[model samples]
Target: MATQYANDIPFSASHDQQAFKLLELPPELLSLLESEHPPTLTITSSKATETTSGYALLCHGDKKYQMRQKNTSNPIMILAPSRTMPTESDDAETFISSPSVTTISKIEDTIELILQEAEVKAAPKNKWHEKFAKSRAEKKK
Candidate 1:
């Protein structure tokens, strides 16, 4: 059976997703995860086998891991794994997992590509009129 690692923690404002940071994984997994194609995250959920409650999952590293979210006093350090557990276990648990390197890098690249395109499209049309106006006003003051 394929293993899984996942967490359902809610994302916070400080969750700064960036591309270069995504490279910090095992090189082969990193290469596999970050394709030039659009990346997609597959989330799954199901009812607990015994209880009426349910759990959520996010897949990374060819494994499916459970997930959860926590509210903390600090803002910047939000969305940490509730707990880190090795794959060997009997009962079910909840926690957050890091994004796979491929997922992270692909996302980062897509965002950068979009931003670059936007900058190119907007740069010439605006002609820096607003920027120049602000600069002239500042000089006068």
Candidate 2:
């Protein structure tokens, strides 16, 4: 005979969905994250240009990858776990068994990363701090 566990909780999905986007990490990113010491990743976007609106890029140290926004028909949901506490309203000996989970949000699209080439890197004005500092120095002069 199999034993039944009494610690089962309920799960629910929220009708109201929050706005959220998911970034699909590349293989190189996965390896970097799995490494002993992971480097911080930065996401930077370009200003609107005459030819194009703009684009985003993800930076990993010296290397950079273009971030492309893509839409999908499939919905991706983000779930949140609900916490429980023992109730003593009737005092018949009731306790919270397990944590219940709920769906908190749904994602509309995903961001894909593409490795940026040397020529591609030259276009956008990056290293924002350097530009700001140079402007300040020029103003001071």
Across 46-99, the per-residue lDDT of candidate 2 in tens digits comes to: 678789887888888887888888988987879898765455664446554567
TM-score of each: 0.26, 0.58
lDDT per residue as tens, model 1, 46-111: 446565576665444345444544333433321333333335553445544543222111122111
Candidate 1: C-alpha lDDT = 0.41
Worst 10 residues of 2 by lDDT: 89-98
Model 1: residues with Cα > 4 Å off, grouped in runs = 1-39, 60-62, 77-141
- lDDT (C-alpha) at residue 94 in model 1: 55
